[model samples]
Target: MEIGSSESQSECNLSIKLGMEFDSDEHAYDYYNEYASAIGFSIRKEYANKNNAQGM
Candidate 1:
């Protein structure tokens, strides 16, 4: 979770900073999705494991 001024994550901003602090992208995405997603969301372990393996 390296902080940066990149357009994608915007590490200088609050959420990304907090996300990096949390150290779990899936959790952070879900937390953000609480407001961002109109419908409920799910964290699939298959996706998590694949992404974790790929360092996504």
Candidate 2:
């Protein structure tokens, strides 16, 4: 199943790049979730922004 914008499903860009920005975390989630679904898989948040100094 597709999971992106209503404008078009075929336009989804499954590739990721550096310095991408979204309006909100929700928008980022939607973009990634769509990419994951396109590749025949689903995504979940295991952890966010892990850093050695932060101990996350």
Candidate 3:
């Protein structure tokens, strides 16, 4: 995903809160991945606890 200047800036100011909604898990990953890259970091592995059946 190509982030424009303004969008990239927002990514730079990345924050996490409880109950954040994303289009999909990949979308969430991309969002964080971009933020991490901009801050001179990379994500090698990801582990999240989610209850898909219960939509938690």
Candidate 4:
């Protein structure tokens, strides 16, 4: 999920919280294959967009 905080200098934070069930082999494989890059890109894009907006 994307979070914004005024106290955070970077303006945005990305966090991945994994539960024990998600640590299972089946879930881990799916997470690495399907969700990892999308999550990474979402955080990166959101931060970049916010930065650009702030600059303008």
Residue 36 of model 3 has an lDDT of 74
Model 2, 1-56: lDDT tens digits are: 32443344456556556799999998999998887676556789766677889787
Better of 2 and 4 by TM-score: 2
Worst 10 residues of 2 by lDDT: 1-10
lDDT of residue 46 for candidate 4? 23
- Please give, for residues 1-56, the per-residue lDDT of candidate 3 as tens digits: 43343454564677545698999988988877877787556785557798999978
lDDT of 1 by residue, 1-56 (tens): 33343354432223423425446877666665542332322343343344656677
Residue 42 C-alpha lDDT in model 2: 79
Lowest summed-lDDT stretch of 10 residues in model 4?
A: 39-48
- Top of the candidates by lDDT: 2
TM-score of every candidate = 0.28, 0.51, 0.46, 0.26
Off by over 4 Å in 4: 1-15, 40-56
Q: For all candidates, what are the clash counts?
A: 0, 0, 0, 0
Candidate 1 Cα deviation (angstroms), residue 24: 0.5
TM-score of 3: 0.46
- Alpha-carbon local distance difference test for all models: 0.44, 0.70, 0.70, 0.42
In model 3, pairs of residues that clash are none
lDDT measured at residue 48 in model 2 versus the true structure, 0 to 100 = 65
- Candidate 2 runs further than 4 Å off: 1-13, 46-56
